[model samples]
Target chain A: MRFVLVAGTTETAHIEGISAAGADPALMAHTPSADLEIVEYGQPVQAPVMPVSPTGCPTPAVITRAVHELTEFEILALDAGLVRPTSAPTVALEAMPGRDIRHPRPVDSAADTFEAARQLGRSLPDDELVIGETIPGGTTTALGVLTALGERAVVSSSLPENPLALKREVVDEALAASNLSAGETADEPVKTVRHVGDPVLAAVAGMTIGATTTDTSVTLAGGTQLVAAAALARHAGVDTALSVATTSFIADDETVRMNELANDLSLDVTVTDPGFHHRNHSAMNPYIAGEAKEGVGMGGALALADRAGISMADVREQVVAVYDRLVVDESL
Target chain B: MRFVLVAGTTETAHIEGISAAGADPALMAHTPSADLEIVEYGQPVQAPVMPVSPTGCPTPAVITRAVHELTEFEILALDAGLVRPTSAPTVALEAMPGRDIRHPRPVDSAADTFEAARQLGRSLPDDELVIGETIPGGTTTALGVLTALGERAVVSSSLPENPLALKREVVDEALAASNLSAGETADEPVKTVRHVGDPVLAAVAGMTIGATTTDTSVTLAGGTQLVAAAALARHAGVDTALSVATTSFIADDETVRMNELANDLSLDVTVTDPGFHHRNHSAMNPYIAGEAKEGVGMGGALALADRAGISMADVREQVVAVYDRLVVDESL
Candidate 1:
């Protein structure tokens, strides 16, 4: 089998740790055992080209480009700046009441990205198609989207040590600001997108629904992505597994609230926490720990596992190998 | 934090998948979030280096080299192997007595590689001591070593599907060829390394023991490697945590024979299966299934989890991710 990995942050994609983590499992499994082919999404999205934000979130324009470039991949598609609502709600608003909610330059709205993803899905072979996503700052946005759509969610930062309070505070504030409530069932909640969600969530939701109808498995590889995808799945009435590749930090109590929100949505969710098994001893550094807590595309990883029928142990080992390499690189 | 993986073969090291299959709570508690780290160990020792074997096992040296060369951060140390006896045996000589048994090539020998590992470990900072191994056909050698030293082991495989019969057959053959009975204890098994086990096993044992004494958590990234390291820990009388990473395939075994072996030596054993909660959906190929049936280094992954204090759910998720990627690659 051949895999063409869609790169989201092109510049960071080549970073030794990131590439190693993404590629190791495929390489190991296919090298001597099966005929495996791998191709990375060639487009490069440079990091640090735009100043690093104190919030640690990438700019929206960067995200749009990331998703736009995903057109190159035959299977995988990615957008750095898209997020989804955590739950379903019935409401429609023409625009936010006070927030300017300006569309950043080189604007590619969630709908645009969604269409692109749908087009990518349309181009695939009729066999079981596997679709995954990668987005940074996704979990926080996932929390915003979920709350905006009326699903109570607990957001946890990816810090090495638990940062439950901070995550919860952010989630609560976002929901309050949006005047959103959890446990609401609506025919549609289009307004939530403008108030709390980002473009990635909408794109993934559209892609997932489109792919599932064709009997494909859509895996959201990060915790945040899973939450966004799950909400979209729920909203769209799509029946497919929603897997979340997380760490112990995310799977544990501090993050359980987020999982509970997922459960409430009746989303077929699976969490893959590589940290619980393969501890990245080197990642214990406070700095790296902080980055980990930010939550990468782990939800999509879990979704991939669900589609693949793989056991958790295998996933943990692979993620750990990648994580260990990442930590080592950071130390260097 | 960075790991350089080297794959070795130790067929006798495998144990039944019953523990994971049963989801034994005790075992679950110790499971690592991730388990295996795939990389090349020196060269193919058992199967011929062909594109495809009659048994469908592709014994490709290129695969091994690919794993080794793909490494970007950590230096690849290919040569040393490690395995633990199910029982405390007096000599390593009585462990593996098959026609294929011989000293691992000097470049691939345990003693030489271990010396290098010792130097490497000594040079690195506390966090940079991440180590992994790849020993094909290792479980058999592990059982041979353990049994020669008087340990009772029900060696099994970690094939995607169960291969209990094939695993049993291999175990029976290795035992039949040995001079030691199943229950005889060897007071000094390490000294007899020349008689029973191969070179890589001895070196890994040495490296792990050496790493532990240095005040850092040394993870045995493979099952056989962990088992072998655990045995060394017992011999050395240390109480440090050695992390063992494995997949759900290993955890599926209900017998807990591998755990029993680790416990017998009074070595702290932690088992992690990354497969339990993975999202991958694919059938296990027979050849790879056969290898899994012969058991992979699940014990090692478990040990790593125990030492790391990781949870089962987390480990399962990570393993699932890796397994999904592997399966996806296969289909491609």
Candidate 2:
């Protein structure tokens, strides 16, 4: 199975308290770009920039890297939309960076981006694809897309507190701005994403649609953002063997209860824990404390590692090694 | 096997009589870009622009698309450097378009582009790759690269006449401008490319290095440009299973005598004849007459189709169909 990382940025990430993708909200725009670099190269090429939450939790790319080292899975990164350029080589679709969801049109050129990604999906050599995404404030935009498609989704957040009310308010205002009500866009998937979703949603959903039309099976990998993609794909009439994979942190979150969302979308879901809660590493403590639940294909990577017969202890060790090498060593 | 088209451009192609890729020298810069779009979509997304020779020979991408249809081989496009934006989605490497070979540094960021492509090559899912290229005036640049690496190479030309004297003069002027002599750069492959080669050479050579390090085997698919890449990779100490695949037109070019170059590089070579010389169609005449002889993975695509039990007649039929659909229909 091939692991493809679909990364993008949204203007919604600039809003204070809306995203926990980086330590400083002003620097969140660089989070997805940095995350892709870290996954591809074990560190960012740009000096002294790494994706971290305010609570000191590292980006989920570390987990993905560990899994890659363990299983040797090949990776390909796709740029849905990027505010800043990444050091990693990416298949560019010339997609525009998403606007704030409160804007009537959050994602310009959604249809074009979708069609391009669909063409890409149809040409991929791999028959099985696990598509992961990295975007700050992606869950809030996930909420936006889910609501616009008329789903009552309690999306998971990277933050510990979940910020349900804040997400709800943002989605409500976004729908009102687009002159759309819940369920109004059920039949118009691309239009719904353009109105309220982010570029990653459109790209991931489009790839899934195209891949599934062939012999390829897709595993949408992330938290609620990927859940939103699954919902969008299903609403867009993609019928195939599709599954959602997320970290146990998201599955067990009190506010998320992701299984219900998966069930609502008629999708199968897989949750992976990597045994971080029981580890003694201080760097992993924030994960147990629920700061960075899931964002960058951690769950899908873990599942691949598991299928390869790699132990969670080994994955934790590699994660710690990567953290120390990329994060701790860089700070020093 | 996966087929990847690595495309780029050079200011060298803008030089008079150096390139025959497009109907006008002024328009040659768009030839690679439009070639990629045609290979991906069977037509350029932008109407009224298709890659063709000044003599009305269609781009070799038609042959590549025909092979893709006959064998369902997965295809990917990589942008080594492009003078113009293409309608097809591409894996962007941020490589700079090459300057005239006479410039001291023809390709900026050669090492960086190489490293990036190397990383991408290491991550590709396929076990075998057929890498091709599309660039106007590529043979002249290939002559420049081959000579810098100390090879007594005679590169093929897209034009009916090989233009050997013109290519040698350009290479000599380029070497003089760089204040280097032939064979002086034998030990510094990346530096050699930066001094006189174009972006596609560096990108293709790097990918060959990276892919050959793993279980992946590579076929450098084209005429002498790919032979130059093979030479670059070898001088850079890439010791692995690598071969050059090209059309019979290149193999039969009296000026090129490609077998000698392959023997000097110690690389195995495969030559594919698509039987265009015996075809009845008017469009086949240009190819038989040795204009637009070989490019855009035509050689490797034909090899793959032949292995897949596809007949040359079927391949020719698809090529004509794509030509009519994309070129003939659009013009009318």
Candidate 3:
């Protein structure tokens, strides 16, 4: 039941103008401290409610942290294209800082990054590993990577109401900007990632390939972002053992159609139910309403916690305590 | 039987002078590319020999690389306190580069690096791990650490003749400069490293503490440097499951009482013989001559490779081939 959590980021999240993700701009602003919190506390508690979406919703990193408390999950922060240094020890994939995905080539170093990631993959044992990510504007880039990989996916967002129009607008602009067409990825998977995907996805693809080659089971954590990464790994022909693990929040979101995305790529999916509605934390209420559903690996963390024998109630109570510590009595 | 090799360097290695080690000055300069060689050829073949010492002798890294090709053990490069960027994926402990041991403090970031290493240890599954390092002037620091921990043991060298006088001179200067006394490690293990040890040794100590915390069997690879780290970890009471693994070239050398050093620490030692003399590679003749004694992950890599059933002949041929490719036929 033990696992390693590879956390990473992409600058493209901040470039897409805040609304692309459900995490609150305030929380997003505090994203720099996420690794610090993880290093200091068993869970992330960077004051003012951790990394919540714009709607006061929490980031999945909190869930990942809480799961660590329950299961002592091994966590490794992977610096794929981050804007800052992580407070925690990090396995640097040494990716070039991501370019604006809006320009049709968000990650020019995709090939080099992939090579490094694949080499990294070649080194890790195939023990079951769950790789997760936290990129603010990741979904838009996911849409880009997916689109380039010949799939038109309906991506979910952090905003509960699902900023579909805004996402669609960006998608349109990104498509027009990149001049990429659907069904054109048969021979250009790496190129597609270079043009539209972020560094995290590319590293994930490379890690998945590397992990699977040694018979290690892999679970891609997060929602649409991982769904897209799964497709790339599969396209690279090393993803038969890959599974996408997310939360019911993302699974039930009509906007993301997460299940459909998984099916599109013939991947297995695991959706953990945190039962936030049964909890006492109002900070979590937005989740039931579908706002800021999933991002920072909450889905995978919850699933892993459950696998380690933690109950949904335990997860809810612990998460509420974290919310209270981080959100309540802001003056403290 | 698969494991990850966390390799990195510390500026301390270079500070001890080119004569402090047996690695050729030319080959030693390319240490940063050793991981690249591991990634490309499954052993180190860094365009030039990765780590020959001042005496024109081969190092344990060369042997480690040859062993890796036969064993195919999983590897991960961990950057403890390196002077340059490694040309491969690395788990950066992000330690401050080392200062000269001639000053009171050699590594200022020992505690911080140790904390990071412990976190790294917490994150890797208690699965078996072989942690190795390559700090150019590490022996002097090892002397500092060992001395600080109350052990006035003799230190080994990359030089066949063992530059004991020069090393003792430096150690005496470092101890006097730091105003540190023997057995002062109750509150100064980390500081001892800071004042006289290198980041690689500190990281090795930290990583050993962290790795052993999770019940994972750990093998500290190399000669005196690792011996010092083992002492610090033991002094801290976190090295119960730790073992020191090294090469016979280092062990058989009359210069380094490596066995007695291990015995003093009450730690188990496993010395793997690569049987290089039976082979035709003149490049390896230096090892039998007792030059470039050990560094990189060679000691541990050799042990693990043997465990994986690789014959000494297999290791020799592979090493010779690498030497031929990277050293002998320079035109090609």
Candidate 4:
């Protein structure tokens, strides 16, 4: 079955001293590269450039854009909240402006935005929905949400060496900011999001509930963020089958306890082997170096392409081509 | 016959020295009363209250809200662009943040935003679509686009008296900025919107095309702003059955030759009167005074209710009740 990827963001990425999204934290807002990449594919981009991870790799949205071009999978860019506006034609979840999570109440209208996303989910065609997120510093929020739910969680990141220290510290600050003990926040997902989580978490979680409530198979297509959404869905008693599809890179991140986190969260995990190691492009190197491990539905796009009988080689070639267009020629 | 009121904004409303939207044109930016009002019928709002015309009648959103509550038609709130975030859950069209039309090219991404709206239009359930728009200062932009499209358009206003001189001057300025003549922009609706229209115009026009392309029975809701959308749909060769449903205030405004404009534009128009004169609430006075002649899908909502066997008195009573809730209890 074809898949649709929902993209969202969070302001937690732009915290004064956090780089959880990528090496250069400021570029986190330009994350919706899929919008421009798809529109200007095979063309030159001027003015604003495609966002680059600190490691010199393009956005994971390139991966999703390539898959869309190759397999014709319908893709959706959802603005949960972004510091910068997406040029891509997006299904605005109408979460409004990018939110700063530094505030005690990060998302005041969490319930309302979630209802909107849920309605959007229920309205979609029955195609399997592969939801993804690209909020910079989002994993920190994810870690915050998961930890609030009482699981010791570590998530991979755009940085080659995961910043476990900073992530933990931020999670601690988030919990403190909420003025709620982690245990108290665990059973209240909506409250959890309002206190510490960003708009993306609430939107994705709501989208999951909407889609799953309608019995659509949903692949939470990223790492810890999806897990946070799954936790919310599970808490809300959503019975639709849900799974996490990611690259082996995320699965094999030595610093992260993915298996334990998944098991603790009761989320099904599916890992795809893109075999980037065997690929010829230097563009794939940053991915292996672990900058932007998985985002913008990269893992899920790869999985869908694979399911459609598209090869890893084909996926790699498309990624490399998009990378060359974006990085080499500097065209979006 | 369910309806979706897609609300958006343009910085054009916030333009200095222009009061084309309403008496207190500065409040034009907070025009999402359609969103919150339609959602919470008969309620008071905080921070941002429902827009009130100079005559002190509430925004037409009150009319739409009363109808929506009276008839259980499914409603969707769409965000094209807004200076303030909508308190209600909304399907965001993600047309970047509100742009100042004073810049001459307010909606640079008009084509893409339209495509997104069109896609959204195509994805709705098989129910007949009634699309409405709410953009403060939108009437002037409507005048600009309509005039550019070769129609001697005179649109109604939120003020009891029309501001024809200032509107014409601004339209002239917009034409000069876009470097286009009235005849030159006639065949190009997207260009017309990008040049002189707001995000609401592009989004609603795109929605019309999308639904019409898919052969969905579509009703263009609201006033002259929707006329611009109909003009775009017609210019684009959309063969779907298209009609506009508006309030009697819009059709019978003696000051504005709406009938001549409609005939000149080759568009079908349907007018619904909620018989607001019989209503007892002082809040409904602004509408009768020619303030906020149409907005937030109020006209279409009333027409749909009237068709569904609801009486004008019933609609008016609901409206009066909501006015009391908003003015007295403030429950939003």
Candidate 5:
């Protein structure tokens, strides 16, 4: 089946790095065997500014408009974006100027982007409705949202090496920031999004729930988005068959709190790391590791499996081989 | 970790099904939150066996030993049994007989299994070793081998649902047959295994491979064996740090084609099912789908994203949810 990739500015530079390393070319070459149709979501762009400046936060209106223009393409692949953390904390925001506290780009909240994604989902044909996202500072926001929603979420800055430590720090910070007790909602899931969540997360969550038609499959590309989408699916009460894919590392205890939230929601999840064999050990930064812990593109793979009526093993082999080659190229 | 499951079984009166089911109470009342080490692999047993004549196939000595010693405590937590198929085409024999070949158990041809799994890795740990099987028409020989290998693989026989049409007819024909391929080496995996594959599928494939030490942070669990595993790791001559889990719907194709095949040749391979959701659907049959496809698990999951760590939205969500559930149970 044809597959579309929604590109976001979240880590646009990272995507560029991957492309420059020939990941895209290698992947494109293998398409014949996998029978996948891939298209990027948003046009390539510079990283969005973070912590709105004196110029003011890029208007959400601009983001909305840009997305609208991009949607003009007959087939919208996937929605993704970049994330930048504000220098100050949310509680300290009152003392800072709006420009100082605001993040660059108008879509401040995951909710906004999620809303756009929802609209995109609605716009697609039933069978063509598949969505995904990318946000650089997303893990941090994911922590924010998960904490805000009263669930303990681990947030980490991207490190080229030692991502586990970063993940631990984020999880610790989120746990400390939240007021809710852990495992209190043992019988059911606690409302994870309402507490310390972001706008983009909310938007993706909305899009996933909104696009729950039988024929459509919604994929949340990043670890943070996957957590958000699970919370959304749980809260939205959408029961259409769904799948989530993430890195093998993110399946660890620190990051797995999000998974617990998903179980409460009765969602089927799949964890994967495509380029396991080609991991860049020399460039191993905690931030990168933390991001690697989250991984990406697993959601779409599941959708493909479902659509193709193939087994999970078949898909894993195809993706892993391509991913390994791509990552190896990057290391070089 | 706490895990919840819905138990289903088609065999109980016979030893074959029971051996393959692994643990029951552990599978059922499995609460991830409880102070217990829980792993759910087997489903519950259903009916008693109906008297039937022997299928007259030579069974492995190892399989026979494992079945005769079955007990309640072991039933709570143990590996499932593997059996050889007595009826059905070689391609369609991946699943157990009378189990509605819709969702067949994944099995790999001997060569593929050994090349992709056995020969690919370092020696396995003794403590973690336990075997399981998935071949149809495997019990009788299990009895024979228990008499020979000193293991219990068969206790009783359950008549096939439609004995006259499928199981019985196939068994009787086999009793009168002779020429069959021997050893792991053969030209065609499906054909080789069809002539000789047995309950060893669950045992040898499951036990030996399961004993290896790999990172479980990411696991590839489902369909076939060798190819699925190799695909996940890509066998690129690198030490793999990722954890892989595999499942089989049929025998390994490689094993049937090669001689002097070593078991540890395919460390990169991890087999698993394609459909992780296991949702009940009338339009699809899991077994058929599995046999038609090859390789799965973590490898398949990786294909959904851009090699740079971009994931498909849907795959991310699904994997995250499943992982979240797994983690939550672990914490419990």
Candidate 6:
């Protein structure tokens, strides 16, 4: 098994109150780079800022890192687009950071990045690939992609209150700007991402589609954002078996229809609960409050840990240790 | 098993008569990029030019491509430094091309690239890694690194006639410009590469050292240039077992001390013969004449093919087919 974390950025994340994946809207651009760096190096080496929710919850990379330390699975970082540089080694696909979602062509490198990632998918030397993503405001972009593909997608938000109206308005305006109707781009998956989606969606979709050509079984590791990738792959004419690994938060989100989306795409969905409420860590309180649901493959990591016979208590302990070491100690 | 081909370049290759990996001195800058592109995509997508020796001898990438078509091993291209861009997907390490060896600091990104490659090495999923390199004028840089490390090194050349005196003169001048004596930078292997060696050497050495921390065994796949990487790893105090894979042409070259260098570094060496002389094709005549003996992981690819029960005749037939499809036919 191999863990591939695809990191990218979108200026749509800059929209105020649209994303909670970073401490501030200005920090959203840096979140993807920081998340992957923290996963690889235990801390961010490129910047002083760590990826945290608006309510001060640590990014799910803490959970991913804990699982990696326990299972010792090979991890690879792929740079679809990054607003900031990371000191951790990454496979750069030379993609440009996405513009605001209202821009007709937000991800100018969509086709190229997809082709590049598809080539990468074909060459991964593993039977199983768990692909995760870290892109602030990605759920909104996921809604845009799913809507463009003719799905009435209700995406999960990192915030306690899902910003359904705000995401739908943004997608509507984006579609109007691109002169696209629902299902207009169903036949052109790459063009769909280029019009209204971020670079990470195109990359993840391309990787999944490419992996289907081989013996590798792909696990899309995220929330509604990865569901958008599954839709993109499905529209691209790939019928290979794929599964979705996501947090119970996403599976249980009243605003999102994860099961319906997975069923529509013929994807088996696995939801993992990390039992964070039982842990008395202040840093994990936001997760308990549903302020930050899932990103950075938290659910997939937890499932791997479970399969490796590591208890949730052990994972939670390691997560706290990582948080203390990387977040608390580093701040000092 | 996975094959990683590290591609880089140096301004030293621009020096006339310094390298024969390309058709002309100017073309040398594109050889590394083009070679890997051919190996991955069966042809160069970046430019119309294909890598060929001054005598129109095709690059060894054709052989690697042929073997890859036969035995489907995951092949990855890592960009250490590329003067020309390749359309093929590659893991970009953001390394700068090495300056002329006459400069005191030839490869400025040596330390950073080495560290990045080291991280990548530690995360590779495969238990066995075959690391090859395609860098024009790399043998001369290898000699520079070898001399700086106090080794009485004899390096191989792509040209039939070994340019020993010219390579020595360049290395000697490089040492003089750096104001360093033999073995002065032995304790600082990264510094040794920074002063005189190319980025590919540092990348290969760093990857080898990093892989030593795991169960993966690394095979340095090339000739004298790889020997330089072995020596770099050795001087860096890495005691883990490593091996060298090269062609019979390099092993038989009287001007190169392949066995001596491997023995000194305690690295097991494997030499493969593709039996190009037995083929009747005009392109195969170059091998018969000992021009462009080995490169682009041809030796390692051949060894893998042999292990898979593939005969040399089958490999030669595929080579001709690839040449006809990619080189001969594409040119027309």
Identify the runs in model 2 with alpha carbons over 4 angstroms from their true place: B1-7, B10-78, B83-137, B142-163, B169-197, B201-332
lDDT of 6 by residue, B1-332 (tens): 87888889988887778889888877777888789768866777554577889898999999999999888776767889887866454667758999998998999899998898887777664589999999999999999999899876689999899898999999888999899877788788999999989999999998888788776899998888988998998898889889888999998999987888888889899998988888788668887787877888888898889989999899999999889877554556
Residue A175 alpha-carbon offset, candidate 2, angstroms: 1.5
**Against the true structure, whose DockQ is highest?**
2
**Candidate 3 at residue B228, lDDT?**
87
Fraction of real interface contacts that model 1 preserves: 0.00
Tens digits of per-residue lDDT, candidate 6, A228-281, equal 998999999988888999988787788888888888889999998888889778
What's the CA RMSD for each of the models? 20.2, 8.1, 9.2, 12.3, 21.7, 8.0
On the 0 to 100 scale, the lDDT of residue B20 in model 3 is: 40
List candidate 4 stretches off by more than 4 Å: A1-332, B15-23, B33-47, B97-102, B330-332
Q: Model 6, residue A176: displacement in angstroms?
A: 12
Error in Å for residue A294 of model 4: 26
Report clashes for each candidate as comma-separated counts. Answer: 167, 0, 26, 5, 197, 0
User: How well does chain B match by TM-score in each candidate?
Assistant: 0.55, 0.98, 0.89, 0.92, 0.25, 0.98
Judged by DockQ cut-offs, the docking class of candidate 4 is incorrect
Task: Please identify which of the two predictions, 3 or 5, would achieve the higher TM-score against the true structure.
Answer: 3
Residue B188 accuracy (lDDT) in model 5: 35
Each predicted model: what fraction of the native A–B Cα contacts (within 8 Å) does it retain? 0.00, 0.10, 0.10, 0.00, 0.00, 0.05
By DockQ thresholds, what CAPRI class is model 5? incorrect
In terms of docking quality, model 6 is incorrect
TM-score of each: 0.35, 0.67, 0.62, 0.56, 0.31, 0.67
Worst 10 residues of 3 chain A by lDDT: A39-48
Cα lDDT tens digits for candidate 5, B180-237? 3122212233322223233233223322342343321222222223222222122223
Candidate 1 Cα misplacement greater than 4 A, ranges: A1-332, B9-77, B81-99, B102-110, B128-132, B159-189, B236-243, B275-280, B283-332
Clash pairs (backbone) in predicted model 6: none
Each model's lDDT? 0.39, 0.85, 0.67, 0.71, 0.30, 0.85
Task: Calculate candidate 3's fnat.
Answer: 0.10
What local lDDT score does residue A96 receive in model 5, on the 0 to 100 scale? 11
